[model samples]
Structure formats: structure tokens, C-alpha cells
Target: MIVITTPTGQIGQQVLERIVDSGKSVRVIARDPSRLPQRVRDRVEVFQGSHDDMDVVSKAFAGAESVLWLVPPNPQSGNSTEYYLNFTRPACQAIQSLGVKRVVGVSSLGRGFGRNAGILTAAFEMDALIESTGVSYRSLRMPYFMENMFHDLESIKSHGTFYMPTAGDQVLPLCATRDIASTAAALLLDESWSGQDSVPVVSPDSLTPNEMAHVLSEVLERPIRFQQVSIAEYKATLSRFGSEAWVKDYMDMVIAQNEGIYDDDLQKVQPSDTSFRTWCEEVFKPAVLAP
Candidate 1:
């Protein structure tokens, strides 16, 4: 049996879609079963509740061979470490208790990446804790998500501009969530690999925020600019959006990225599908260019 957590989320939903279509015996843990699509509900055994709940995961892990784990983002979370691990800790216990062998988890690049790197640090720690459990694990160490660009939809639509806390000329890695989900589905379905490892899902193409602005402008047929904001200004922006709880930690994370914490990670993994231009044309342009 293959168990998936957060099946309704962006990555999880795609993973569930691919897995269910293969006609595998699948189960999911969700807080609200109604959020699941009608077809999905009909297909998989649903254990309704947060996967953080020991009882919920325990039930889902029963007779389970492989699991896809994704920790939902808690933007207002006070401590990224606690927020991530608290949810993962229970599953670690359950993995040992249930004798489950394989786990494919969504994680970030940089293991000892940077100081005060909020959720990234939390993700690095989560990898450590899970590995200690002696379970065969594949941690998809992802870079900046292109889908993260969508968070700027309103900014793009209104002003033809987007913001980030990085040097505008620095070439950095990026990937789409679709690639991450596709890779996860491939891993979870096979059950052929074993042992703990971190897999980098980085793109072959690297671009600066300035270059991204040029591509976005050409694609949308408008003048779009990339604005490099200060860490304090970034915090102010987050605060305005009611995301102040982890502001300091988030600030450190962006700084770490700009500092090139994952330069080694980028060199490690083969580039998967999805390019920046493709995402801009297919994903970003439509939302901003729509009537």
C-alpha cells in the first residue's frame, strides 16, 4: 500500500493523481475529506484528520509499503523547526512502529545551509531526524519554486513588477512544483531504491531576478521589473500580508540563498523537466495577461 499525506496540496494532489491512476492501493490522511475531489474520494481509503495526529498516521501506515510526505506550509508559524518537526516527529515514530520501508519527502536544499534559515533549516533538521529512524528515505531537496512566482500575481498584474530579497544579477536555480511532483510519483511507485539520500530537483537553467524580469516582460508583452528589496522591507511586506510570525527566520533564509548556500546542491542533481521560460509562458503569463 502507498500512503500519501496532504493529498489535496499542490504537490500531494499531483502525486495522488498519478498514483491513483496507476490503480495502486492508496490511502491518504486529510483534515477535511470534503476538500478531496469527488473522483479522488471514490478511489482511495481516506483517514480524515491532520497527519500530525499519531492515530491518523498510524492508521494510514498500517500495511503501507511506501509513503509520500509533505509538510504543509505554516506561514504564521512562530518557529519553523517546531512547526515542521512536530508534524514529522509523529510519522517518524509511526514509521518505526509500522515497519514501513520507503519514504519520499519534500525538503529543501542545504543541509547545514545557513544560520537562522527558518524553514530551510527546519527541513534540513527533518531530514536528519527521519534518517536516524533507519527507514529508507528520499528527501527531495528542492530549490526556489517557480510556482512561488504566482504569489506575486497581483503585483505583476497591477504594476508589471515583482520583488525578491536577492541580488538582481545573481544567477540562481529554480524549478516548478510539477517537476517535483512528477519525480516524487516516479520514486513512490517504483519502491526499488533503499536507504537515506537527498535528491536535488534543480533546473538546468539558472537566471538572475533581472533576467527573469526580461523573460517575464517579453512573455507578457509588458514592462515588468524585478525589485530587490531590503530584508527589513521584505519583513514589512510580509507583515503587511500578516506573515510576521516568522519574519526574522524568513529574512535569514533569503539572505542565505543570496549567499549561495546551495551552490553545491545545484551541482549535484541532474536537471529535470520544466524551464523558466516554459513556466512563465504556461503558468505566469496567463494569470498576469488574463482579461
Candidate 2:
């Protein structure tokens, strides 16, 4: 059996679909089973609860051969480090007790920046805990998702601008979530590879924010611009909604990004098969045009 956490999530849903197509016995841990597509419900066993719950994961991990582990984002989390670690610790125990042979986890880039990278630091710690479980593991070290632009959809449509807490000229690596899902599904299905490794799923293009704005303008046929906000301003904006810890961690992550956190010399990276312009023309354009 293959166990998937966050099966209703963007990348997880895609991964579940692909794995289901292979005719494998699959199970998922979700808070609300109703959120799962009916077709998915028919094919996989549903453990209706958060994966962080020991009872939920212990039950789901039982007799599973492989697992796809993804730590869902919680912007409202009181402590980002504790949030990631606490969510992962239960699954690590379940992996050991349940004799699960392999694991494919969603993680981020910027492993060795030697600073508090907020969420990225938390992800790295999650990767470590999972690895310590001694299960054969594959950490899909992902870069910035192109779909992150969707958050600024309203801003793009209304003001012709998108905001970021990064230098305009810094080349931000990008990857589509579909590519991340594809990578995870492939690893989850295959039982051949053993031990642990990091698969850096980054897109081939090396585009700065200014270049991204240029592509958006041509694709949408509008005058769109990239606006670089200061870290202080970004923190202030985030502070309006979430808890103080949440705001600090998010801002710290952005600070790490501005400090070149994702600028690691990754070797043997099999570039993800999506470009910024392709994403703009295909994904972004439709999103902007949608009513």
C-alpha cells in the first residue's frame, strides 16, 4: 500500500491521481474526506484526520510499502520550527513502527544557508527527522513555485503590479507544482532506489523578477511591473493578518531569499520541464483572464 498525506492539496492531488492511474493500492490521510474528489474516494482508503496526529498516521501507515510525506503550510502556526517538526515527528515514528520501506517527501531548496530561513529551515529540519527514521527516502527539494504568482492575481488584474521581497535582478529559480507532483509520483511508485537523496526540482529558466514582469506584460498584453518591497514593509503587511511568530518566520524566509538562500550551486539538477514564459502564457494568462 502507498500512503499519501495531504491528498487534497495541489501537489498531493496530482500525485494521488498519477499513482491511482498505475492501479496501485493507495490510502490518504485528510482532515475532511468530503474534500477529496469522489473518483479519488472510490479508489483509495481514506484516513480522515491530520497526518500530524499519531493515531491518524499510525493507522494509515500500517502495512504500507511506501509513503509520500508533505508538510502542509500553516501561516497561522505559532512556531514555524515546531510546526514543521511536530507535524513530521509522528510520521517518522509511524514509519519505523509500521515497517514502511520508502518515503518521498516534499521539501524546499536552501539547505545550507547557515541562517534562520524561516520555513526553509523548518523544511530542512523535517527532512532530517525523516531521514533519521532510516527509511529509504527521496526529498524533492523544490524551488519557488510558478503558481505563487496566483497570490498576486488580483494585484496584477487591478494595479498591473506584483510584489515581492527580493531584489529585482536576483534570478529566482522556478518550478511548476505539476513537475513536483510528477517527481513525487515516480519516486513513490518505484521501489528500486534505496537510501536517501535530494532531488532539486527547479525549472530550466533563470529569470529575474524584472524578466518575469516582461513575460507577464507580453502574455497578458498589459503593462505589468515588478515591485520590490522592503523586508520591513513586507513584514508589516504580513503582520496585519497572522500571529507575530507567523509574521516573523515568513519575513525571515523572505529575508533569506533576498540574501540569496536559493542561490545554491546545485549539481546534477534535472531541470523541471516548465519555463516562466510557458507558465505565463498557459497558467497565468488563463488565471488573469478568468472571471
Candidate 3:
């Protein structure tokens, strides 16, 4: 049996879709059964509760062979590192006790350079905790999501521009969440790989935010450009909705990216076929054009 955590989430749901289609026995742990899409509820056995709860994970892993593990974002979280570990520690305990054979976990790129990297730092630490369990594990380390571009839909429609703290000329790696899910699904379903290994899911192209603007412009047939925002401005924007603790987490994350935390692993293993332009045309356009 294969188990999935965060079953209704962006990456997790995609993994669920891929695995459920394979006709495998699947189970999921969720906080709210109602939040789950109706189709998903029909297919998998549901273990309702937070994955952070040891009881929840223990029950979910019962008789399970593999699990697609992920920590969903907590915008209200005060500390990024603690937030990730809170869910991970229990999972490590459960895996060790349950004798589950394999796990595919979603994590980020950057090992040495990611220290003090805020939210990403937490993700890396979670990887270590799970690896320590001696379970067969694959850490699907990823870069920026191509879907992050969707945050610009409104501005692109109104002013023909997208914004970020990165220098317009600084090219960064990008990946589609769908590709991450595909990697996880393959690993979770096969059960062939053993031991602990980190798999980098990086993009083939080094597309700068400005180049991404051009791609969006070309695909949407509109004038668009990248607006470089100040890191201070980035903080101020996030501060409106998040506590100071939460704001600091994102602030450090941006600084780490600017300092090239994941650059080394950005182009290794399984360069994604999904391009910025393709994602723009397919995913971004539909959402921006939606009423």
C-alpha cells in the first residue's frame, strides 16, 4: 500500500492523481476530509487528521509500503524551521516503527549554502531527519516553481509587468510542480530504489526573470516586463499578512536565493521539459483570463 500526506495540496494532489490512476492501493492523511476534492475522497482510504500528529501518521502508515511525504505551507507559522520539523519528527518515529519500505519526499535544492536560508533551511533539515530513519528514501529537491509566475497575473493584465527581488538579468532555475509530482509518483510506485538519495528536479533553461517576462509577453501577445522590487519592499508586502517571525522567514529565503544557495544543484538530474513559456501558455493564461 502507498500512503500520501497533504493529499489535497498542489504537489501532493498531483502525485495522488498519478498514483491513483496506476490502480495501486493508496491511503492519505489529511486535516479536513471536506477540503479534499470529491474525486480524491472516492479513491483513497482517508486517515483524517494533521500529519504532525503522531497518532495520525501511525494509523496512516499501517500496512503501507511507500509514502509520498510533503509539508504543506503554513502561512501563519511563526518559525519556518520548527514548522517543518514538527511534522517530520513524528513521521520519522512512525517510519522507524512501522517498517515502511520506501518514501518519496518533496524538498528543496541547496545543502551547504542553504544554511540560515529561512523556510528552505527547514526543508533541508526535514530531509536529514527522515534520512536518519534508515528507510529507503528519495528527496525530490526542486527549485522555484514555474507556477510562481501566476502571482503576476493581475499586474500583467493591468500594467503588463511582473515583479521580484531578483535582478532582472539574474537567471535562475525553475521547475513545474507537475514534474516534481511525476518524479515522486514514479519512485513511490516502483519500489526498486534503495537507501537515501537526493534527486534534483531542475529546469533545463536558465531563464532570468526578465527573460521570463519576455516569454509571457510572447505567449500572451502582450507587452510585459520584469520589475525588480527591493528586498525591503518584498518584506513589507509579506509583513501585511504575516507576523514578524513569518516575515523574517521569507526575508532570509530571498537573501539565500540571491546568494545562489541552490545554483549548484539547479541543473542536475531530470532537467524538466516544462518550460516557462509552456507553463505560461497553458497554466498562467487560463488563470489570468479566468473571470
Error of 1 at 235 (Å): 0.5
TM per prediction: 0.96, 0.97, 0.97
Ranking by lDDT: 2, 1, 3
Model 1, stretches more than 4 Å misplaced? Answer: 112-114, 241-245
What lDDT does the true structure give each of the candidates? 0.87, 0.90, 0.87
RMSD to the native, candidate 2?
Answer: 1.2
lDDT of 1 by residue, 83-177 (tens): 88898999999999999989999998877554667768988888888888999999998889998888788999999888888889998799888
Candidate 3 per-residue lDDT over residues 75-158, each given as its tens digit: 789898888998799988999999999989999988768369998899999999999899999998887888787777788889
lDDT value, candidate 1, whole model: 0.87
**Candidate 2 lDDT tens digits, 1-291:** 999999999899999999987878999999999999999899899998999999999999999999999999887888888999999999999999989999999988889889999888899999999999899999999777899998899999999999998888988888999889989999988979999988899899978999999999999998999999987888888888888998888888887877878777455577888888888888789989999
TM-score of candidate 2 against the unseen true structure: 0.97
Total backbone collisions for each predicted model? 0, 0, 0
The model with the greatest lDDT is 2
